[model samples]
Target chain A: MSLNVGVIGAGAMGTAISQCIAPNTNKLLLYARRKEICDDINEGHINCEYHPSVKLHKNIMAVNDLCDLKDVDVIFLCIPSSVMRQTMVQLNDIVSDKCIFVSTAKGIENKTNKRMSEVIEEETGRSAVVLSGPNIASEMMKNLPSATTIASIKKKDLEIVKNVLSTPKLKVNTNHDVIGTEFCGIIKNILAISQGICKGMGINDNAKFAVFTKSYNETKCIIEKLGGNRSTVDDYCGFGDIITASTLNVSRNHTLGIWYGQGVYLDEQTGVLFEGKNTTIVLKEICDKLNIECLTVNFVYDVIILKKSPKKAFYALWEKL
Target chain B: MSLNVGVIGAGAMGTAISQCIAPNTNKLLLYARRKEICDDINEGHINCEYHPSVKLHKNIMAVNDLCDLKDVDVIFLCIPSSVMRQTMVQLNDIVSDKCIFVSTAKGIENKTNKRMSEVIEEETGRSAVVLSGPNIASEMMKNLPSATTIASIKKKDLEIVKNVLSTPKLKVNTNHDVIGTEFCGIIKNILAISQGICKGMGINDNAKFAVFTKSYNETKCIIEKLGGNRSTVDDYCGFGDIITASTLNVSRNHTLGIWYGQGVYLDEQTGVLFEGKNTTIVLKEICDKLNIECLTVNFVYDVIILKKSPKKAFYALWEKL
Candidate 1:
């Protein structure tokens, strides 16, 4: 069936996904927080703060209200984690039943370890899917090759996602294992931060790589142990994405490592968000509750958020490994 | 036990390993092919091809004859895969009786899917330990941090290998999964070439990441299916080393990917003998013999070696996935 797509957040991710799918030709709607924001978007197709280089589709328009998107067949929640709950609260009644719920956000609700898609499904009272991979929004806007996994419980829902998101430049792979995909996306940043901190340690390249491999395997174990698919770790939504996220400057957490290398503090101009910051706490809780080694995430929490020296946290975690 | 480390070959890999262990106050022997080569190394500490940056150790004495190493406690076979069999045959009778062997070469003997360690063992009539990891000769000269794996079917042999190799900058981890680590070092270059091809496709970041994940999983499958330890995929010898090999310019294979993207051929200047060029053929044969899916490696094979256009090979592989 032909689909009408609605992007619920006119941020960097929203722009990237919008460009990935149909633009002027297909029925499309974009939702932003304010009319001024919509005006800025309409006047200039680019999101100035995020993707300053790429332009947007002419047919894509920003709306101040969710009811404006009622006719759309799929809704992509691209808002940040902090605003997702409020955004969902406002759209719950307005969103149509025909629309497939999907989230492009990469955070776990600290209050609950619920993934973004979980929160969407819970808020909208409908099954939801999550899109996760190693993505740089700026690069996606330039129509550079990228891939991501769309995860949902139903194969039909997955097909709908594939239909809506696929483009010549953006390849979307689907999996029935939503938990594994979402879990990999959220937890990887924490690992990236831990990786950053390890580079901060006096440890040489060998120790850094050993640490990277060990922490990644440890992350995979936690996800797989929780009844998620082992094969998920083999996909872009898993290992490759995690590597890009941890190693490249494209990631906020990876940037944390760069800053740590340069001895700079995490600040606003970093234009990077520790997407896993909220989830680090939740992950530690999950580890504590399950008694599985959440060694990497815990190391990140202690070394980064709590201001613990890598020497102390590294040894603490090193002993466990 | 006090160890006498003997290194065969005076080129980069051989010289680096010799220098690494020479500072330990051990009697270090360097086997050179020509008399002049031995004299040059004895007179000056420079290894022309591999590491020109580091100074050689005073304890290292270059000898042209193999019998001079007969009293050595450990012998490292640092010859290329092409000539290893011939050298192994010569060393079979000359090596010390209790000397454990370690190999610095990376490759599967092209015509026979035999690993470097396997070739050395058969040639020397003794299975030397395998030193597998992403150890850069140039980086090793700088004494940069890097890690490697030392493995043997025998526990005592592995212990001997580890103690000799483990240093502050280059820590050696022990494992029984010698085969797995070997495949990772060889196959990752092939995958790095694939990574470059995807980059050349100019696809979005997510799509690129997705292809990487698929390639990684597929590589893991080929290794595990061939009777390797699966856990090494997340260890320094395997995944970590692969990361270093694939992601950076330090890898010949990675450079090959860049050349493939730029429409150039990967050759000797790539830093190391790019195993992907030949290993893909061996990998194809191994997979065929073992009945495993080596989609990523085989894809690179068809494109790079078989002279098929990359576009056609990519689409063919994409459709199957």
Candidate 2:
């Protein structure tokens, strides 16, 4: 039997999910925030901003309201992480209590200081599974195989999510440790930015490779110390996602790092939203309270967010190391 | 003044390390069993087998006699792990006492079933340090800035090794727990081979991503069980090396996996003398004896070494999982 799938946020990820899930299942709906994005996808059969290659299925529905997602068996929250908290607030009012919600967005709420899954559970009084990994929407839309982890503290929800999403072109492995998966996704950005800063400082490729390796180890260290299962950071969501994000241009965070490597300011490099920036903001505060070794991340955070030169921040961090 | 360095083996790693160190110090020697290879490197100034782009320094002598390496401050064992047990006996007799030693070779010694550093200490009375983490030999000679870990159980030796190896392009970081770093390096090869098997199965990128992430977690689990500190793997030698080995084509282990993915037999794909292939043999034996739940690695070992078909291996593995 085909599973019912609903995607909240008709952005790149939502469209990508819709495209990925549509070939197998009949019930697919893409809920867009703005009337224009909804109309745009419905009329043009593609998400212009995220995936131009995606051809919407005839059975797929594109709607502007959250009410459209009411019947979905699996609801994937694909919107920006910043707005996810508020979006869940509205989703609580509209969506069914029993729906197996999933999040594709990888970020923590800056104001509420909540991960997407945490935000969802708080707002809707239900824990939803999270789907995240090295998912570049463009590659996925083209039918390139991609993998991610579907993690939830709740095993039943995770299995349900794994069943619905575990298809050939896309696979969602199950993990009970949501904190590890979420932490990896958020913390990866900080290191990528640090790598970018190092590259900008005329550090050669070996130096870059060294930093890349250390950053991964350092991030894993931080994750394991925070009561996360060590395995959580070892595999797909943790290592694969982190490596893919920091190494390739596919990641917005990594791209910002590359720009930072090229001596561009964080604000100028992004020109769009990056959740790792906010994650870094919270990360610094968390490090101070937790007493973790975070000068590398702190250095990049200052250079990118505070408009400091990459050099000054880099020297500061390297000196401490 | 920097210590004069002697790299035993005169292979890919030995030559590369010699070249990288020679640019900074006058004391560089390459030891080999074959007169021709030593002669070619000394006379022709090229490492024909390992890295061809870089030239051998004039002061760096390539000698077939172990007696030539006696005056060196540090002698690096760059031989394969499988043969290190037998080879170390010979080296133990030839090399001087109180000489600092390091190892570039990665693998668990098959017979004694020990890490490279342990093998060095067992064979020779002198204790050893590890030069590990993402230190791709040829890449380092290109003057690409690279960083790696120098680790010993002894803090004083670790600091001494770290300081001597520190150069502008080749940086050295320190980690105290070698059991973690060495285990991370060897176990990751087993994971890389598994990754290859997955690629051979035509799994989606997401599945691969998922598997890759999970593989590390499994590695960490085994390492922790082995009584290695998490911080060792959490630093350059553990997680960093895994990322580099799994992702880069420079690693023959990962390449062996890529060949496995392409439907070639393990021996045919590896073309003999691949460390990852030997790693498969050693890891499977260790996991089986220890009752470690290492399905991914064990499954690959079953397929590649035990003559099971890839499909058969997968079915058995999936069932157990």
Candidate 3:
């Protein structure tokens, strides 16, 4: 059951995922776009930039070329969603035909609104496995107790990915609802930003959680409309991740929302990429096309994108409640 | 419609609720059992025992006699669940037959496991509206924006109660799922304690939220099995209150779980009532009777009532995850 696993990207998530699965895999080839990071990882056995304190597992080998992943049985695409399609196209050309792709990116393709897995399948002609949950990369790097949900069309692929990913300290739940699993990751960003906006606006607990409750239910509705089970929204990727991102300060999207809520708008030079801003725009379009009304999405859209006053948007939201 | 309103119990919640509805009512009579609290509220325009800083509305009158509520059109029973039945029986003998009763207590009857609404119905032979949400009394006292859910069998009663309770700052949503609304309040205590136990045990965020996701789904399952709609758990009472009590320091149930999780057991002589302890014992019995397997319930039961090691119980729970 020991498989050759390739993890694409050398960012915090990529390094952390590589560390988590290295013990279970025969060889974990982590593909870093930068030659320097690969050299650092291979020579010193440390991802010094992301995780400096801990030594990398012996089974993990960092590679600068995507061709090094050709022999891998599984590839975890931990790259950003903006680059997911291009990376998948390159990996499709290099990797083995039997290699199962796992998507950890949590965004829909801008304009086309295709999910990461959809884009991967269109490019690679294979259904991609989706991984998501309340997994903080720092916590995962430390091997603190964590759990995640993985979804795929093929049950065997799910079993293989589950085995590759799960440890006594890192639990993995498997399901067949790819749409629900992927969208949970996307929708959670909106939830995080919405909660963050309320927090930044100094909204009370009762009102904040009430809006949050509405947002949570609206998520189920959106997922169900997209042909996924409503019950899937109760899984780790949905309830667990939404709460983690919205309530905790770990998420960049939540922080972005907080800044907008407090009337401090960051310019493009801020350096932090907020996936939620893109998500909010894409989801608003999706909801409009589908004739669905989500107050949470509208609230975030009004405040973040339209640059409307948070108080005015909040008052409008309160009126509907 | 300036209705005559009466609020029983001058505790934090009762006083806060009275303060919220006082402006909308013709005469808001807040009933306190103690003469001293009533006198203080009446003479000083404040419930000194519960809300000292906020001045009581001029329309709000503090009364000590149950008979004082006889002329009221609506009565909000904000007393402890332990004394709910006897108080309902006493009110049944005094209040007008047309008086609408609102049960704000969030606990079930000890032996019968009857919901507060059911107990009020059994004692008074009248349907009682149920009120619940992520309401923090201290926040509500400050006229902070808050929201709540109210449920009753009669649609007319729902309308009347909604109008009586609704304010610009206090938003109210109405539903017909009395069972779901009541149980959401009852089960949230369990959720709060479960999350608190994880916090006290210093379990990682991923595992804690993963278990919380399970408990939340199990709540929907239990409610549906008890003849309530599963979707009701998505409402303010379920999602809102669960997050509020579990995450915040406002709930005594959560604090109790933290103590047990930390292995610092407090004697019963400590004045604070851990309603969640009674709820856990009762819910365990109920789940056993209904043949429902809830890991969250079992984990809390092991750590608190059975005095089992938190580490052992957590391991058992994680194995299932």
Candidate 4:
């Protein structure tokens, strides 16, 4: 079926999502909050903040007003988790009810600790699908092949998403375990930061790999305890994304981990959105509320919250293992 | 308990394994076929081929004769899989019957398709323990922290091994699933090569991550089908080792994959003994003989054996996923 697609947010992830959807859809709409981003995409087919070299498809229309995308059949919510609620409220005031909401955002809300899809469904009053994976936006802009998971409880929505987003370069897999998949994406960042600490402590690949395997196990237990399928952590969004983010130096989380390893603490005070650091705080809160003991999570909390030295934390973790 | 240790082979892995055991043992004996290597370690306190920088412990004695290790309490079989049977046959002719054998070898035997532990038990008439992990020889030589899995059917032997090998720099986890753990170590090389192909083709991290997740799933299924624990593949030797080998550019298998991606074929004719290349053929053979269909293994087989182009094989794999 021919589809009218709209993407919210003009950031790197938003631009990449627009490029992925642009070549296949009948008409593509990009609603950027900033008029300059909208004008730039509309006039020059570029989003310099995300990708400076790649030229976007001509069919991608940039719009500043949410009302301009009311006719679209699907809206890919690409805005940050901090602003997701407000963006959804604005779209709900103008967009049609039939439009399917698919989120590319990879985080839990600050106050409610709710996944982005939950926020989408609550605000928009529509069933939503969440897409997450080891997708680095810069690579997508280069048309490099990558795999992602799209999760929705509804079978029909999954089929539609597969039909819309699947391309030679972007392979999409469908999963019904929305909670498990979302949690996997969120927790992997914290694991990457831990790995960075291992690197900073001058531990070899062996220790880093052990930490990775243990993190996956620990994350799986936490997810299963929370009523999500454990196998979902073994999927692209969980294992795949963590491996990619942890190994590549370009990731913000890994960078934060490197700094953490070097005994430098980074917080919101740095004006950096190191999602793993924030995720650690949220994850620890959830674990405590749920009364589950995750050793890796606890160790991370000790380092990030209790101000334990990275070397001391590493040795403590080794002793525990 | 005070233990006397003996290590076979003097290659990089053998040397590193000897170094790991030497610092903890009452006395360490290294059996090297090359007189120069034995003399180098004993007289000069250096294993030039494996580790040139680190000085070996004074208690570590090197010998060129297999009979010199006959009185040792335990033997760490660090030989290559290609010569495993031959080496075992030689050791059996001289070593005592009560010696506990711990193997650091990490491949399935070529012609027989048996694991090193299986060959060890058959030749030595004793229960065997196997060790595997993301323990890169060079990294281990540097005394950088790393983790390894030590698996044995006997609980007492595992404890003894833990006492003998566990050091401040290297962490060892115990497991009872010998077959599954060994297979995990053997198959990870093939996965590394596949990852290298993704790199050579310039595929993005997302696709590579997806392929990795799929490969792990496929490998786990194959192990379970063969009467091994499925969770073993998720352990340090399986998941952790693959992550280390595949992500890093220093691995031989990844290098082979890179060459394959560039349309450069690597084989024994090229004077490179890439374990992953040999493993793909053996794994495909095992799957066919067992009447099990592994899509990832089949795709790798087609790429290596059927002379299918790497790009086409990659696309075929994506289509299957």
Candidate 5:
């Protein structure tokens, strides 16, 4: 059975998903907002914006209109969370009811405080799977091996997702906790920023270890309170991703954190989009509303909101210690 | 009230501990096996072998004889695990029971499979405290801020250990799970080697996450079976240290794992000691006797004992996955 695959969005994650799916499937239709990107992908067999080095698989075809994917068996949504709801609503009017969605975007809707998958289910009335880990797009394009988890509420959908996403270079495991998995993907970014702050502040590995310990404990508590399995963050999406994002020099959030720690304004940084900045604000608000004692989040909030230097933020933390 | 501080070794960690304690204590006694090291410290006020840049505090007095520390209130044992028992025996004959011991050495005796803290308690008949985390001696000596946990069986002893160890740049948290804390410090080296193997084998962050997840789960199970709090490893000494050691390029165990992963013999490498190699064999034997199923340990055993390549080791792991 050759399932029809459609990737919505021409972002790095979408391109990577298309590349991974191209080898296993008979047809891969990639939907891009810009007509030129779709044309380039179709005619040149390359995603010039995201993955331009390797030639895309011949099975892939690009479509400019969402209606072109009316028969897609599975659609991977990689659009940013800000426009996810509007896109999903528009997608619901065109795509068939049988289409399954797998979201790679990691974020919570500020307006509703709902996860991307939850928003997907609400807007399109379709259950969606989430795929996330310490997936750095640049490394994946270099053909380096990596692992991620595909989580779905349904076991059958999870198995199908595993079959579709897993490759020799990209190992995909099935996770039952969609909420926990999604939360892990989002919360790690904030923690990674804190790690960068630690590094920029000239903190040693021993101190970083303490900060991570406290952060992970707080993350577990939030996961459990949200009616999700606490162990999800302890695995790939949480512990692994957080460590990679925080410690790896090239990570955007980490870089931003370093700049922030060094007293550089977030806007002054040129070539990076720090997801942790937004996540920190949203998460801090949530924590305050729920009375969750998340010291790491508060410290990050002080840097991002209160405009405190890394030294001052650390001094505040020392008082609690 | 002023306390008498005695550091049992003049190695990097011993020197760092002495440096941290020098500003707080009234009398700091550093005991070294070589009389020349003691003479150099007392005369020149510098431990060139360990920390060359930092001048020793004038209050520090170095002594070569063990009997000189008999009246000391606290002694930090920082000698290597191979010589721990012999050193403890010598100290026990001289030091009074009131002189509490704080061990920073992280290792398990091959003959007894007992942790360093256990050995200290058994030999000296004193309940000792353990100081462990990602305490990189070189970084600490440079006054780079760091944090670690101080664990003891008793709350009173834990408080005293915290007071002795906690400095402005070095934050110390108290833990009651001494068994779990000690095991975390010892086991992380083996796990770090596994991480290095992954990096050497060209494995991506995804696969590494899976490996760590399984390793941590197995560790928690083992800790629980050993009658220790399972959550102890989830803190600084376990998760924090393991991640830092594995990811950091400077870690010796990670470097050793990389060499082994690349098919270099253990003995072929000079100026490096891989504690994980010995830990793998000893821990495997321990797990076997206890009927604990630890896949990561078994994989490491296959690599070291069976002389399997990373490719073969991962292939075996894939079957289980």
Candidate 6:
């Protein structure tokens, strides 16, 4: 019953997911873009760069060439969203026609406002399954108890991915709402930044959580408007991930927002990219076109993008409440 | 334009609420059962026991007798849910017939299984306005930014309470879903204990938040079954308060769950009176009678009430997920 699985990228998430599903797969081919990382994972039995203390599973074989994935039953696209489309285009020419693609990236195209699944669909000429939840890669690497939601339009695809992802330590829930699953990952970044901004401005706990409740409902509204089930937002991908990213200090986007809230602007020269910054702009545009007014999106946009005074933007949001 | 308002109970919540609305009232009467606290507030302009640093508003006058509330336009019942019925019965004879009652208690009568509002109705023969949210007393005492949801069957009552409670620092959202609002306060205790048990058991973030998401949706389901709006769970009363009590360590129920999870059973002698413990027992009975199979409630009952191993109960809950 085991399938041949391949995971693209050797970053934290890519390495961790490979570790999670290696036991369920006959052969887990983890595609590392860097030659040294591939060699280290294959020979040393460890992802030395990201997860040095933990050893990779015996079933996981790190590969540097894309051709090694031609026989995989499924390829998980763990690359950054910025490179997802091009990676899919390259991967489409190599993988078999029946090979299913799973998107773990949580970003939309800058200009097209297309989700990662849409990008994979455009490039692969097939529907893509999405995997998302309150997963922290480091925790997954340690094999701590975790759970996630996998979604696809095809029930068969969902069944396969669910089987591959679920283990005693890692639980997976399957659903048919692909858009909701993927957008949950995207919208959660905005929620994180909004909460970070509130924390940065030293907003009280009651006010912060009040705004969080508003943002949570707005997420359901936006997802429903995009033809996804509103109740999907109550799932692990939506509520679970949103709380994890927003409340915990682990997310880079949340850290970025804290800096902005403190009026310390982090420029691009820092070399750290925040998908949430781009997400705020893109979501603001989406809400504007749809004539939907979302306070969370606007608050993050004003403080982070427009560089408005954090106190002023916060008071404006509180006034609306 | 200003109405006479009275707040019963000189506890932290009562004094803080009085401070919040004193600006909007002509004469704010805060009823303290203890004669010394009443004298302290009236003579010193401070509830020295509950809030020593924050000065009570001059418009607020502490009263030692129930007769002092006779002419008040609105009365807020801030006493323990255990004393709520009897207090209402006493005030029923003193307060004017046209006076509005607001219940800030977040408990259900143990034997009767009636909510605070229902208890008020039984004792006073009036529809009591229900006020609940992620309101922390200390923060509200300092007039820090806060928001709350008030629900009443009557539109006029909601409007009047909203006007009295609304301040630049305190935002108020009014709704007609009194049942939903009342149940939200009652249900959040279970969520707090569940999350606290998870934290005490050292459950991973992914697993904890995944169970949290499930419990949240279950809250909506149970509320709906109890003749409340499902969407009302998304308001300040449900999502806001649930997150506040569950995530923050300020809640006694959360700390109690932590102790129980760590295998430290505290007897009634150490009792600071955790409302969550009683809430867990009552909710289990209610769910059993209603034939609602809720995993969160069951998990909490197993660990806290039945004295089951925290790890065993959590694993059982995770297996279902």
Worst 10 residues of 5 chain A by lDDT: A266-275
**C-alpha lDDT values of all predictions:** 0.75, 0.73, 0.92, 0.83, 0.82, 0.92
Instruction: Indicate the residue-level lDDT of A164 in model 5.
Output: 80
lDDT of 6 by residue, A1-321 (tens): 899999999899999999999999999999999999999988999999999999989998999999899999999889899999889888889999999999999999879999999999998889999999899999999898888899999999998888888899888888999999999999899999999998888888988998998899899999999889888888889999999999999998898888998889988888888889999999999899998889999999999999999999988888887
Per-residue lDDT over B1-321 for candidate 2, one digit per residue giving the tens place of the 0 to 100 score: 777778888777777777777755657888888988887887888777777667777768888888777777777778877777777787677666767788777888766678888887877866688877777776767756567777777787776667666666566777767777788778878777777777667755554665666576677778777878765766667666776676556667777776666667744543477777677887777777878888777777877777577766765654443
DockQ of each: 0.51, 0.42, 0.81, 0.65, 0.55, 0.84
Q: Is candidate 2 or candidate 3 better by DockQ?
A: 3
Q: How does candidate 2 fare on TM-score?
A: 0.80
Q: What is the lDDT of residue B69 in candidate 4?
A: 91
TM-score of model number 2, chain B: 0.90
Model 1, A46-65: lDDT tens digits are 56665676677776777888
User: Can you tell me the CAPRI class of model 1?
Assistant: medium
TM-score of each: 0.87, 0.80, 0.97, 0.93, 0.92, 0.98
Question: Which of the CAPRI classes, incorrect, acceptable, medium or high, describes model 4?
Answer: medium
Per-residue lDDT tens digits of candidate 2, residues A61-90?
Answer: 788888877777888888888788878888
| Colliding residue pairs in candidate 6 | none
Which ranges in model 1 have alpha carbons more than 4 Å from their true place? A23-26, A39-55, A58-61, A96-98, A195-207, A225-227, A267-295, A308-321, B23-26, B40-53, B57-59, B197-204, B265-275, B285-295, B308-321
> Which ranking of candidates, highest TM-score first?
6, 3, 4, 5, 1, 2
Quote the chain B TM-score of every prediction.
0.91, 0.90, 0.98, 0.96, 0.95, 0.99
Best by TM-score: 6
**Quick one: ranking by DockQ, best first?**
6, 3, 4, 5, 1, 2
The reply for model 5, stretches above 4 Å from the true place, is A139-143, A268-273, B266-273, B304-306, B318-321
lDDT of 1: 0.75
Error of 3 at A276 (Å): 1.6
Per-residue lDDT tens digits of candidate 1, residues B1-321?
657888998887788788777776378999989787787777876665456556788888999999898888888888787888888887778876787777777777867778887787676667668777767666676676566777778899887777777666566778888788777777777777888776665545565566777787777788778788777777777788777776666666766666666556556565766667787777777778888876787778876787677777776776565
Top candidate (DockQ)? 6
Query: After superposing candidate 4, which stretches have Cα over 4 Å from the reference?
Result: A124-127, A265-270, A304-307, B302-308
Better of 3 and 4 by TM-score: 3
Least accurate 10 contiguous residues by lDDT in model 3 chain A: A266-275
Tens-place lDDT digits, model 3, residues B1-321: 699999999999999999898999999999999999999998999888778899988988999999989999999999999999999989999999899999999999999999999999899899999998889998898898898999998999999999998999988989999999999999999999998889998988888898898899899999998988888888889999999999988889899888888888879887767888899999999899999998889998998899899999999998987
